[model samples]
Target chain A: MIKIETCLTPEILHLHQLEGKIAVVTDVLRATSCMVAGLNAGVKSVIPVKKVEEALTYAAKGYVTAGERGGVKVEEFTIGNSPYEHMEEAYHGKSICMTTTNGTVAIDAARKSADQVVIGALLNVSSIGRYIKEQQKDVIIICAGWKGNPSLEDTLFAGALVDQLKEEVEITDDATYMALSQYQSAKNNLSEVIQNHASHAKRLSGLKAQNDLAFCATEDYCDVLPILNGDEITIK
Target chain B: MIKIETCLTPEILHLHQLEGKIAVVTDVLRATSCMVAGLNAGVKSVIPVKKVEEALTYAAKGYVTAGERGGVKVEEFTIGNSPYEHMEEAYHGKSICMTTTNGTVAIDAARKSADQVVIGALLNVSSIGRYIKEQQKDVIIICAGWKGNPSLEDTLFAGALVDQLKEEVEITDDATYMALSQYQSAKNNLSEVIQNHASHAKRLSGLKAQNDLAFCATEDYCDVLPILNGDEITIK
Candidate 1:
């Protein structure tokens, strides 16, 4: 089997090469990580969109529009980028239309190659790997970098998936080794290590971001793999 | 001061944002890492180009055109992507134009904004960090993700840079953190972890790539940073 990899930036998408593979979409800094956190808190599903307007449009259809910019929850939206914010009381059984600077775009991009696109994050990293192995298909892990550039956080998640899945399949592409080695350096002091990436510092513009970072860092906290189908992302 | 936070792909230069920042370009799987290794092995400053034709034309000017496709060194070229291959006797003090799948594109993009764009790799991880800190300007660490997507291996290097420089500055991007965490996970199994990125597996297609992986996994071996100035990248 082939392992397809891509980084999400505004203009380019590795979607072309990811066809017929199990598309594992990761926006580790917030989206996928948040998805894992929100699901663990029992939120039903998250509908990821590329733009705030899309999230709003989806919310108009009885979904909660969750939007964040530069890391904080948009004051106008029901939820912020932080998974901790996602744990609030009103989240249960609700459909969230989530949009962010990086993750949302990544989720939307991964939608292109997704026969079965699973959200892979620090919260449930191994779950996605295990799922891919169980399905036994070609695996494509797309990192939704901030605003489409390669985010260190997203690639690290991809690297983690690579570490877990390479035993089962043949991986192709340069990104695989770049990430695997990078993961080797900072897997311990995650917060300190990622401080160099663009999104973490931008989100940290507010103080609560530490909680967001901490929340997203928890591993295997939930088993829900949010999969995108049509306009909605639901746990499969 | 605001830590310069940005991500780099094979395309989309982000020139406006990264302009005037100390740009650190990393293509760990082979390009940047191999560049460092080649330089360390006594090869001269490496040249980066987008197309194979450009490399050949440069070689006509008394330079060496090194090329790589699907990880293996092309027989026609004077050198392959492997740093080891670049350690040939003829390579000494000779300029080489490297055109790889993702790395050359990334180096080209960073050229637009770079006040001083440096080639970053596991080999020169700490020295580059020190140089950036000494400069006291915004530092932009650009990862040449695989064909514009975050390859875990590349971004993990970004994380290592972030980790090295965290106390010296700030990390605004959430993407950085995600990679940092993955780096944390892979730190213990450096050689094995690096062997798992898409680029590594792809490069290992025929050779004993495991050896290359082991070589790339050795961290902080060199304290030299290759600075990119216009079309020329200098090892400082």
Candidate 2:
């Protein structure tokens, strides 16, 4: 059995070892959630850019532009980083070029470790779980914590994944158990579960992200799986 | 109010900033806890040397030499880094020359933050707490996490201190609150609380040091405050 662990702090993530593993990158606030939403709305692929200029170049190429900066949607874009924004019909059958505050960085990190990378959120748990089971290799559930720091939501999703795949994987660290313990506690409702965490509270105070917490918290929302395929992401 | 924060990761720890603050160097698995137990048991002061030759040079001055290699105490030393061994009445009033795995590295890092530096553990929580409070400055609760990694015990102590002084300070990240929340969940009974952590279990597996965990967990057991007074550390 492969070791499934939660890295609360992003610096602790062993970025080099993600190769040949199916990496489930989670940024619960908006990145992975929005990626999941975009994929669900029939977006063919999502390119994550760390900088807005990079996103703009993709936008100028006629790719659908989407992202969030300072918690607000970037202007003149087809969509923002909010998963709620991905629900519109305009997002369907499009290739989305996105940049986000933290999620893309996490995806960037995962792209190295994983032979195939998938975006996992409460919005796409069941599909991600099934995808991992099918891969049959070590699965590193990478939680993209906020701003290179361990945020509650990412670790909570790590725990949620652990709760789903416990008997199959060997767990590592108090971080994993602590996260799973939290996931179990908050499984009924993530809103009450993450009330005290600073990042969640900050996101709650921002624009278009209130229900994002509850939205990201609800498990198995869609059965679709997002797989990163050679510079393009595909949903199956 | 001082920004008293527990930086859990080692690399994330601003090593160069150790120049100014009063640093409480701690490595609970044995280093700091052993230091505290030795001092409290009446050992005058332990002169910490980074190298064995330096410790041997101090050992030439009629000091009880103590240290560890590969988790085992060295045979050349009269004492080892076990808090229980240092707790004997025979230890009281005797000055020791010692070294260890990680605490000294932290002390070295802490020597950069500011002027005053001190040692902290469950044994002397209140003493260290009140000392930091009395200092009336930005208190950096540096947890000598294992090898610049996120250690469970060290972060737990950081959380404990945060819980003790949260109302008196401003905590910055979700890590601070998350640790405090975990400590709160486990405060009334630390053993049960600690049992959930992996490091505690691993440390308890073989070494006679298992009892030291309980001893260190007992709040306010030691009134002796170990502080770095210069190139050398002493009790304040």
Global local distance difference test of model 1: 0.71
- For each candidate, what TM-score against the reference? 0.69, 0.88
Cα lDDT of model 1 by residue, B43-155, tens digit: 77888898888887887887887867656565667878777777777677877778888788887877876787888888788888788878898877778876555565676
Taking the tens digit of each residue's C-alpha lDDT, what string does model 2 give over B54-143? 778877777788887655677778888778887778768877777776776676666765577788887787788788788877766666
- Candidate 1 chain B: worst 10 consecutive residues by lDDT? B197-206
* Cα lDDT tens digits for candidate 1, A1-236: 65545444435663356567677777777777877778767788888877777777776787787868876677768777777777776888887888888777766766776677777897888778778777877766677765545666776777667777666666455555556545655577766656544454444655677667766666567777777778777777
**Residue B64 miss distance in model 1 (angstroms):** 3.6
Cα miss at A121, model 2 (Å)? 1.9
lDDT by residue for model 2 (A1-236), tens: 76765666556676236767777888888788888877887777888877889888888899988887766788877777668877677878878888887788777777875677888888888787777777777777777776666787787788888888888877666677767766775677676666555565565664446676667767778888887887667786
Candidate whose lDDT is highest:
2
Give residue A168's error in model 2 in angstroms: 3.6
- Fnat of model 2, as a fraction: 0.43
